[model samples]
Target: MTAREPRLLVVDDQALVRSGIVGLLEAAGLEVMGEASDGFEAIEQARRLRPEVVLMDIRMPGLDGIEATARLMAMPEPPRVLVLTTFDLDEYVYRALQVGASGFLLKDAPPDRLVDAVRTVARGEALLAPALTRRLIERYLAAPAPGVLAAPATELTPREREVWQLIAEGLSNHEIGARLYLSEATVKAHLTRLFVKLDVRDRVQAVVVAYESGLVRPGAQRATH
Candidate 1:
């Protein structure tokens, strides 16, 4: 049997851009459940349509994407958010991640990459590239946002901490398993425990907590395979 395509809500202030994104995703055989021009509308549509993934634009006239993302995440059954921005290193993208966005994509990303990102987030995986992840975190860590306190890393066990470190280094669960000589199932089990200890909702949030808590510094050397 064929897998079901992810249902999507495309949110952009610009009509042209929103339409283009909708067309691209629809053409790729994904379902476009609805579209919204701003954050407030996005939230309403999300509540009603209940898409599996949301392609959210970073800027809007009144309610911006970052704030919208936070509101959407606050929902009882929030859809996975894949942020879209014109700039690769935008601080707004980091803010979105802070509020539980699943991942982000450059607006100019290749069509295939964009489609793949939707599927990735839909499957509950983050889509941050290793090098770009490092740069984005390093740039934002200089002045951490208020009320965004660091998670207490002391709560994690030694094994969980090692898994967390690999996650921060942008390793997939499978890759982490291979690197540590553990099974993928074991890696997922570790992730589940660590996520609870860290009070993070997902891997993206876990990575954020790792950097914020100084458990994983922005420029720290990553483990080699």
Candidate 2:
């Protein structure tokens, strides 16, 4: 049987941009479940529609995407959020990821890339590129926010810690498995346990936890097991 297309909620303050995005996704054969003009409506629509993914804009007039992403994550069953931004290194993008955004995309990204991003996040995977992930996290950490503390990773087993480090280094499950001489299924199993231990919902959050908690330092050489 064929898999079902992911239902999406497109949220942007600009009507033209929102329409264009909706058109692109629909053309790509994805379901456009709803659209919202601002963060408030995004939250309401998400609650009512319960789409599988949300394509969010960062600088909406009210509430804004970061807070909206946070609120959505607090729901019992939150939709995966792929934040849209004009700049790849936008600080708001980092903040969104911290608040449970599944990933981010550049507004001017190719249509195919955008579609892939939505699908990737909808499938419960983060869409951040490895290089971009490191750069963004490193830049954000330079002026780290006050009062935001990393959750301790002491509860994670040694093997799980190894997996977590690989993830922070931007390795995919397949790559991580190859690097650690484990199967992909085994890698996923470790990730599942890691998420529970760290109280993060997805890979992006896990990466944030790794950096914020200082379990993996940016620019430091990866430790060999």
CA lDDT of each candidate?
Answer: 0.88, 0.89
TM-score of each: 0.92, 0.93
Question: Model 1: what TM-score?
Answer: 0.92
Note the residue pairs that clash in candidate 2.
Answer: none
Per-residue lDDT of model 2, residues 64-164, tens digit only: 99999999999999999999998878889999998899889899999999998888898899888877888888888763444444555877788999999
